[model samples]
Target: MKLYTEDPERILIYGGSRKDSGEIRGIISGDTLKGSFYYSSYGGGTLKRYPVAMLKRENKWLLGKGVISIYMGIPSYLKTEPIDYSDPKFIFEEVKK
Candidate 1:
C-alpha cells in the first residue's frame, strides 16, 4: 500500500513532536488496520519492533479514537507510524483492495 503521513505539523503526538518524513510506510490488512514498528530506547537492547494499529484519528492521537490513536502517535516512543491519508493507489490497493 502507498500511505502518506498527514502534514507533520498537523499531525502531533502526545506533546507536539514534529514528526519526520519517511516515518511513513505502507502495508495491507483485513477489515481493520494492522502493522508493526520498532520502539527504541537509548540503549540498543531496548530497540524492538512490535505490532501496532493502522487506523485513523478524528483530531489527534488519543486512546478514545481507537485505531486512529494508533495512526497519530508515531513519535510517542510507541514507535507508531502515520497512516496514509488518501490516494487512489493507497486506498484502492492498500485499504480497500
Candidate 2:
C-alpha cells in the first residue's frame, strides 16, 4: 500500500493487486489521524498491525485511527498524485513482516 496526501490530514491510499484507491480525511491529533476513508487496504489486514508509520525524509509518523474506516474494491475521490511522506519500502516490509 502507498499513502500520499494533498494536505497533511487529507490522504490517499493505493493498495493491492487490484490497485484500488481510498481517501482519509481528518486532522492529525496527537499521534493519530482521526478520519474516514474508502478502499484502504491497511484498514484491517497485515498493514493494520501498525496503525502508524514514519513518513519518508520526515520526522513524523502518520497515525490512523478513530472512525477512519475504508471501502474496498473501488476507486478514490480524486485521481491525482499526492505527496508520499511515508516510506514505501518500509511500509511494504512492515505489512509483509
Candidate 3:
C-alpha cells in the first residue's frame, strides 16, 4: 500500500490487485483516522465505496466496528455484514517505508 499525507490531516492510501484497485481517503483527527474505502469490483466492473474508521494504536491501524458490503458470485450479489476487527483474517496494518 502507498500512503500520501501531504496535507497532514488528509491522507490518501492506494493499493490492490491488478484486476481491482483500492483506495482509502482518510482524515486524521487526534489519533484516529476516519475515512472511506473505495475499490473496483473484479467481476462487476463497478466501484465499491464504504465508510471506514481506524484508530492508531502503537503504530498500528486498528479497525473500528462497522458493516461492509461484499460482492459475491458472477452476477454480483452484495452481502453486508459487520466487520470482525478482532479476527486475524481482518488485517489493518500500516506499512512503513
Candidate 4:
C-alpha cells in the first residue's frame, strides 16, 4: 500500500491488485488523524469500506482498531471511539530534494 496527501487533513491510500484504492479524511488532532477511509478491493476482499483512526507514531502511521458505526447510510467510526495505535501500517518518508 502507498500513502500520499494533498492536504494532511485529507490523505489518499492506494494499492492492492487491479485498480483498488482508498481515501482518508478527518481531523488531525495532535499526532493522530481521527477520520474515515473508504475502499473496495477484489484481491484483498469483496468489499471493505469503513472508518479509520490512524495514529502518527514516531516515523510511521499506525492503523488502529475502533468501533465502526453507520451514519446517513454510510459506515463510519463513531466520534466517541478512540482509535488505538496498536496496529501500524507501513508508510514512507521523502528525502529532501
What lDDT would each prediction earn against the true structure?
Answer: 0.33, 0.36, 0.54, 0.60
Q: After superposition, how far is residue 22 of candidate 1 from its true place, in Å?
A: 11
Query: What lDDT would candidate 4 get against the real structure?
Result: 0.60
Show the colliding residue pairs in model 3: none
- Sort the candidates on TM-score, descending order: 4, 3, 2, 1
- Model 2 over residues 1-97: C-alpha lDDT tens digits? 4445534332334443434234444456554343334443433343221123233224434431222222473322222434343434434212221
- Candidate 3 RMSD to the correct structure: 7.4
- lDDT minimum window of 10 residues, candidate 3: 70-79
Of 2 and 3, which scores higher on lDDT?
3
**Who is ahead in lDDT, 1 or 3?**
3
Please tell me which predicted candidate would have the highest lDDT against the true structure. Answer: 4
Residues 34-87 of candidate 4: C-alpha lDDT, one tens digit per residue: 666665553355555666676766677777776778777778777786766665
Give the range of the ten consecutive residues with the poorest summed lDDT in model 1.
Answer: 88-97
lDDT of 1: 0.33
Top TM-score prediction, candidate number? 4
TM-score computed on alpha carbons, candidate 2: 0.31
lDDT for 90 in candidate 4 is: 45
Compute each candidate's TM-score over C-alphas. Answer: 0.28, 0.31, 0.50, 0.58
